[model samples]
Target: MSGRTSAASPAWFAAVRPVLAFSYLSLSHLATARDSHALAALAVGMIVLLLLAEPLWHRRPWAIALAAIAGIALWQLKDSAHIHIALLLMPVIFLLLLAWLFGRTLMPGHVPVISKIVRALEGGDSEAMMAELDRYTRGLTTIWTVVFIAMALINLALALIASPGGLLARAGIDSAWSISDSQWSWFANWLNYGLVGAVFAIEFAYRKRRFPGRYKNVADFFRRMAALGPAFWRDLFK
Candidate 1:
């Protein structure tokens, strides 16, 4: 019984880690709209989680100290008007980071990120299947990069247009470029997710048609994607 419990521990940790990490991320986004104190707490929580989960950070006491200091500073400065600006810019920053992740791999000498994921999923498939997977995955990577970039740009545009003291205001442009803050918030917090979900559904449909031989049903595809999460994070951080 002790041996079985010990053997199951690693598998349990592996299964729970991604769920915890994603929950933390989602909480951070939700906390941004609260107050500076909430955001600062979220920041510290993330750093603590990272240190606990990633063995490499265990030896880096200085890094942990610096992060704690930064988090404290953020908490101290929470009442500043700048904190509001940071909250407003959060969606743009997240989208841009995703864009960079996908776009950077598209450069010369780097395997497409989606292809890397697909290869992990395929494991020891036949050469013919691999060749088809490679082509399809590369195309999907390109599509994802474009989508992220577009989302980032749109988020940025909305942020600028909603800012009363931003460039558009200084330029005396009072058209659609001067949208309300609530409207921008609606897009950033709500519609943005809907857009991504819609795109994912559309892309799944396209993939089904484009790679009929390689494509499985949506449920299977998602299951494979879920299985790839652990490997995905390891590759991403490495």
Candidate 2:
């Protein structure tokens, strides 16, 4: 790990950073105006930046050229309100990416992703300090991987059945089962956030009961998470 924190990272870059990406996705789905669809463009671009910032920084000249090319491409599509369709595919891509990140850590030799984050946030013997906590963390990592993959699959199904330009509609195929664009948005954008937040909250409440001394409450746990600092998160995937 480089142990280097830069302006590229802050508290949001850590545990709950998915909210940063997911928020844009939700808003993009609610879009009804052309300019609003532009939000999708911005959202997707930011996701790229978030994931590749370090590599981009390491190759500054090439990054500059790529950014310029991307900007021009976006400008060319500014008139297309169909950009919001990207939101239909956004969750599938984003959640699968998250699934991969967590799932990979669960492989035989590697540390579970949640276990690593807990250790970093604790800055001590997080797993050892509590009985079976390591086992719990490993299980939690598996849960996240499964959860994200499930969410991605649901989004894919929704994208396929959604009308007014969905996969089925575009193919001139009609199905007895289908949903409206707004209805799809209702799930992909709003319901998905509720589900994710509920999961996090449920975990916190359960942890409070299971691991009483580690945190005073949920807020305290989040505060500890924030205090992990940028360096910990910057090196997380590496």
Candidate 3:
């Protein structure tokens, strides 16, 4: 019984860690505008997770200390309105990071992200339909890169327009051209996800028409994509 428990410990921790991390992130976002205490707790939790769970931080004690200090500072300032600055920048940074991820893979000698994903879905058999799959997946990767870039830009624009005494406002731009904070929040929090889903649906439709042999139906394609989530994350982190 002791031996079995010892063997299962690491496996159980590996399975639970990501779920906890994701839940913390989701709750952080949801509580950002509504509850300062929750946001602060989430921020500290994330910092602790990074320090304890991430391999990169294990060897860098300075980095861990700095991160903890930053987390503590943020937590201390959570009750202030200035904390909203971090909240506003979160989506913008996330979109930009995604754009960078997809764009970086398009460089010379690098396999496109979408191509890697499709290859993973196809059981790592690149030789099965090399020519067609390569071309289509590269193009799909470009599409995703462009989509993420566009989303990032739109989010930035909305944030700028909604901010009081922002660059545009300081430059004598008309108030009529500026957006409200609520409007910006709507786009950053909700419509951004909607637009991404819309793009995915549109891309799937285009793929169906362009590559009939790839998937039998939209449902099958989405199902396969869903199944590739773990592989995608593994490839992403690697």
User: What TM-score would each prediction reach against the true structure?
Assistant: 0.72, 0.80, 0.70
Candidate 3, 1-238: lDDT as tens digits: 2454223234344465566555555555555445465474565456356435543223356666766776778677766655555556566787888888898999998988888777777764557576678888998889888888888888777766764533354455755567765566667766788899998888888877875677888788778876765436545624
TM-score result, candidate 1: 0.72
Q: Model 3 — TM-score against the truth? A: 0.70
lDDT of 1 by residue, 85-176 (tens): 55456678778888888888888888888888778877789999889889888888888888988998888887777745333543567756
Q: Which of the numbered candidates is closest to the native, going by highest lDDT?
A: 2
RMSD of each: 5.5, 4.2, 5.5
Give the winner by TM-score: 2 or 3. Answer: 2
**Higher-scoring candidate on lDDT, 1 or 2:** 2
* Winning model by TM-score: 2
Report lDDT (CA) for all predictions: 0.67, 0.73, 0.66
Model 3 ranges off by over 4 Å: 1-67, 123-128, 163-176, 216-219, 226-232
For residues 138-190, write the lDDT of model 2, one tens digit per residue. 99999989999999999899888988656677668886789887777778777
lDDT score at residue 47, model 2, on the 0-100 scale: 58
